[model samples]
Target: MSQVVDDSRGGAGPFSRFEFLVAGRYLRARRKDAFISVIAALTLTGIAIGVATLIVVMSVMNGFRDELLSKILGLNGHFSAYPLEERLTDYKETVGAIEGVPGVRFAVPFVEGQALASGLTESTGVSARGIEFASVQKLDLLYKSAVMGSWDGWDEGNGVAIGSRLANRLGVSAGDIVTLVNPNGTLTPFGRTPQIRSYPVSVVFNLGMVEFDSFYLYMSMQAAQDYFKAYDDVLVEGAEPPDVLATDEEIDAAYQRVYRANAIEIFIDDPDDIATMRTRIQSQVTRPMTMTDWQQRNETFFSALQVERVVMFTILSMIILVAAFNIISSLVMLVKDKGRDIAVLRTMGATRGSIMRIFSMTGTAIGVAGTLIGLGLGLLIAANAETLRAFISNTLGVTLFPPEVFFLSTLPSKVNAGEVGLVVALSLSLSFLATLYPAWRAAQYEPVEALRYE
Candidate 1:
């Protein structure tokens, strides 16, 4: 150990080289003080572990949220437009006007409703949608990634596309026939009759999201109108039996009132400006319209993810707090162990502030060293998180995450430098604070009192 008093004899500056050297010497415990060294080591280790864990966890959460946004928003429209009641009769003209609106990327007529899908071997509930294939094909998930299907033969009159998960459940494939039962069928003299239509499966797509892939079906707008009985909302459910048998003129008039499109799905130029786009386009159309953004539809789910991240960070920070307490304990014991030496220093003209500075530096040195080590370890683990997972799965024969359930094929991490800086400052601040009580206690010693005990 470097001898501070011997090497820096009569140093002029207060709390200068002599203080730092003595502080360094005190940190390396003597043989009899091995137990104090262990506690000091534990304090450093605890702080290190806490800081590293927090960094890795925050990065993973950020990556997870980003991944979810990309996958979910890739398939769904940014905003939806619809009338208050009856379907838009002039939807084709409306869609054209919407496309011209500022910030609007693409607009298309959409028909969607519930139906009972019956396959060769199974039957399930589905949200069948009528779509303009050209506009739908522009989506990245539908064309570039996440989905596996061809646009070929998809609007070939009455042909429909099914999701991969749904196809697997129904035991149906391309070119196979699937029947859809529409409960909102035509009413008859006896009673309301359900309508059924059989269509060929044109393709199978995978949306990657389990909820979407397992429950959504798509077909041409014409097929949806025919199969779903989509028409003008001109019929009163409880009218007085129509007073007579409906004639061709009355039927033609009512059929004309039926609009082919129930809603308009729109893609905005910038998804982030959805609210601004909504305001800009709301006045363009005279019809009573309701507009909803993707965020509005899924606020609860995303909010929960954000809340979990905050809670995890708060909980992990407590670990560092516990480590600070350990530092306090270690420093207090060091002060007690060096009471006689402290008196010697005081007798040799050391001021109370100088004594305090020496102990403070000792405690702070432990903190700085631990924080650096922890920072390096944390970043290493975060960068190699996926590799670690793969290694565990392969070497230990334990599967970490199943892609189907988790909606992600690999672990992701995105460290924010600002957050890391904040953590370092916090850890160092806490370490400095922990030294105050012990350092102050050391400076309070009276040379005569300490020497009498010695």
Candidate 2:
């Protein structure tokens, strides 16, 4: 009975410490088959490239998703409340009650209508939003983002705001007069007729999104009410008139007292809370109608992105699978070259299981080392993709991704821990699995046969 001197400095079990030693010896030993070393190096390089690409691609996807989400939510209110079919008579009271609801940040009565804006050179259809100018300023970040003019002018009658794209298309600047033509027009005793009015472009805003920048316009609630006659007359014949619509000026005065005087729109800070409030307000106040959040509005675009991501990931993973096969080939070649050494070890009392363990550990070492190197490289690239792009562009006079085509002006990347972890685990598992057959074949060799061949 030989005393097993604790070879491990920590007095750990013999098998535990010996496995590492065996793995190291096998890896360091020079072999005649230089092809095996080349194959192993290729395998490592393959894994590193695959991992790095996946990380960088996924990070870009995440950044795009985040950028679009912020732009959409930041431009549009989280939720809106409106009348179902009938115009709200007591909007102030309704908005007040809604303000008391949990998560209600701001509730402002808004009216939307389409009109053609004509400048000196061009005329384009635009979406006009009627809101409390001061309240809207607080809710919309665009007020602060104005490129020219002042948002304060929106408080005055006949004041309007236009996007930069629309301004350029119309060849107009701040203080320029633009004609607003409402196709639906106004109702009178004679008949419905188109209403054409002129308003000064009080402010010019630029939000960066092409669609919004090209079509969005803003006006004060008073100006909108006057232009659209949204508060004027009931369409019904001989219907019992409410105490409200007594006369034109009287009705306007009444609306001013009842609604505009005390009404203030509240915008909730949290997106989740805003969503909840929207749902609650719709259920309680508005009639059943299709409503969509900004995310859902662009579902197809987002869905396409997701599909692209999945396809890209699948394609990149094949590179790793190919590398795993390289690992298998290297191990097989190594086993063949060391046949005589394996036979001697067996004769010296090494079991087949121990032989298998040794080869498996060797394959695992290659995989783990490659994965760690890849992970570090991938993270570095993802963290500084923009800087890297800038450097490449400057040094080589070549752009990685040009800003003109891409919605974002620069390369965007956001590394997710979970995604990196998944890549690492996947590579390790594939490498371990690749070792099984080669290791098993080496272990199954008969000592006499292996010694005879050598």
Candidate 3:
């Protein structure tokens, strides 16, 4: 017994060489205590899995929100301005005025409305935007995301640009004809009828967002106005017709009216400073207009995302907590199994603190190793999240993240360093605290009683 205890009692300082050797020996449990070894391994595995899962889930949620926001803002601008009363017939002047304001990047006056679009094979409802060729050029996202065809002659030619998804559903491509049916038509004695017109598909774009790709399409401003009949100053319901011999000026006045814009989409230099920019824009513009920022428009969607992130974090944390309990149980069993060994060390001049330190070291080592492994694993999985999703979908023959359901074309992952750090700190802290109760229990064992039982 003396010889057995000699090697474990030589070191003097806290957590010394002798203490580590004893802890290591106990961790590699002998055949008699193999069950305790199994429990310790399970504890390590649980901690690692819990940490990895937490990191991956949180990163995915962050990426989802970030990706959605970027795509939405890219296509829709930072905010939009709509007229309070009457139509925006003076849209050109309004766009110029908004563009001149500080912090304003550019303002585009657009006419947007709902219409049923028909291709040869399929038909679907679309939110159609009427924008000029120059305005389309300024839209960097749409300009760059073109999958097929060119924007050349888009405005000059009476053609429209459709999303790739819409084109696919319609079984049409660039140069193919698509018919648009506007439900709100000119009032007649027989009541309003749907206005139907056809135009060539000038270009195809892929916005990478399901809603935009599948439900939104673009056409020339003049085409949209003519199709929707968005004109100001309509003549009376039964007004007298102008005479055929009327002067040229009278004929022009009776026939032509100003085209009206539904809203003006404004892009600004700094999206975060939207409130200040909004105030400045309103002050400079003369017309009575109402403004709404992107955040205001999608508040409910983003709020739900935030809430889900928090809830997922809280739920996943419990996994680590359960692993902590495993650490406590495994350490308690190790202490009981090594009671005689602890007593012999105590009798050979080893302090009670030394007993506590040895058991604590054993538990903490499992925690440290597990935490390091989990951190690496978590980062690796997060970095390749999209790739993995693709692989799984291909192998399984089912879409894991369908664009129509998820609203994103791909699975996204963005690992926040701060969040990873917090997960590691939490795991390590729980592991260390779990060791205290078992380590203290081992330290309290009396050598006389433990040896007597042995």
Q: How many residue-pair clashes does candidate 1 contain?
A: 2
- Residue pairs with backbone overlap in model 2: 105-266, 105-267, 105-268, 106-266, 106-267, 107-265, 107-266
Worst 10 residues of 1 by lDDT: 1-10
Residue pairs whose backbone atoms clash in candidate 1 = 231-258, 232-258
Residues 207-252, model 3: lDDT tens digits: 8888988989899999888888878656545555579898977666
- Quote model 2's TM-score: 0.78
lDDT of 1 at 145: 36
TM-scores for all candidates: the values are 0.81, 0.78, 0.91
Best candidate, TM-score: 3
State the lDDT at 192 in candidate 1. 79
Q: Whole-model Cα lDDT per candidate?
A: 0.82, 0.74, 0.89
Which has the greatest lDDT? 3
